[model samples]
Target: MSTRRFFAVALVVSLLVAGVASYYASSHPDGLEYVAEQTGFIDSAEDSATADSPLADYQTSGVDDARISGGLAGVIGVVVMLVLSTGLFWLVRRRGTDDVDSDDARPEHARQSEA
Candidate 1:
């Protein structure tokens, strides 16, 4: 398959996995919350004052469908991380190689002195 088709299939597969994860996520407090509750600090957990944030509780602020909300957030997080990692790698990879000519390879000490 073409690169585009491969990416599309990968995305669909990732979303499906995330959807399943959302379906199976625990209703009880997670590790942090459980610790807090057991330690008698659960009351300290205040509502995020940023009520306007789109993702407050790993759920879209106003979304009512639990599965859809979590799945969407998971997908969004994955896509954002993929884009950021790709950009970082591209930047690092583009720093040298075919673009830099052999003639520009001045001695390291000389190059450092110029700066």
Candidate 2:
């Protein structure tokens, strides 16, 4: 499949999983939090620096419905990750060239001899 089509399908699947499937997730704390609580150090854990962010605790702020809040947060998270990763890939990606004599494609000794 084409790259664009692949990415389009991936984005749709990611958004659907984030926005719809998240509602079925367990309400209990995740593994780390559960272990912390069992070990009696849960209270000692400090809030993250983003504790006051709108998406804190995987829920959007000021949203009445838990499902909507969590779903919104999940979708937002997926979008942010996709944008950041795509931009990074674009920035670091190799640009193809038709020139065979490019310095990078030449052996070190040949480049030194030319210089």
Candidate 3:
């Protein structure tokens, strides 16, 4: 498939998983939290600096519906990642050279030594 078509399909799938499948994710604490609780260190765990952020704890702030809030947070995360990754790729691509095999492109040591 064409690059554009491939990216379009990927983006659609990402959005669907983020906005729909996320609602079905397990509600229990993740591995780290579970381990901490079992080991009796849960009480010592402190909130992250970003605890007050709207998307903290995988739910949007002030959203009464748990499913909607989690889904929205997931979608926002996916979009942010997409934009950042695409921009990074664009920048790295711009710095690449089209020439693959050229003696002039290599350093002097890369060339065969004169007899």
Best by lDDT: 2
> In order, what lDDT does every prediction score?
0.77, 0.90, 0.90
Judged by lDDT against the true structure, how good is candidate 3? 0.90
lDDT for position 11 in model 3: 95
Q: Candidate 3, residues 24-84: lDDT per residue as tens digits? A: 9888999999999999999998899999998999999999999999999999999999999
lDDT of 1 by residue, 56-103 (tens): 666765668887788777777777777998899898777755456553
Which of candidates 1 and 3 reaches a greater TM-score? 3
Q: What is the total number of backbone clashes in candidate 1?
A: 0
**Deviation of model 3 at 68, angstroms:** 1.0
Give the candidate order by descending TM-score. Answer: 3, 2, 1
Q: Write the per-residue lDDT of candidate 2 for residues 76-114, one digit (tens) a residue.
A: 999999989988877656333434437678889988998
Structural similarity to truth (TM-score) of each candidate: 0.65, 0.77, 0.81
True lDDT of residue 113, candidate 2: 94
User: Alpha carbon lDDT of residue 3, candidate 1?
Assistant: 100
Model 2 TM-score on a 0 to 1 scale: 0.77
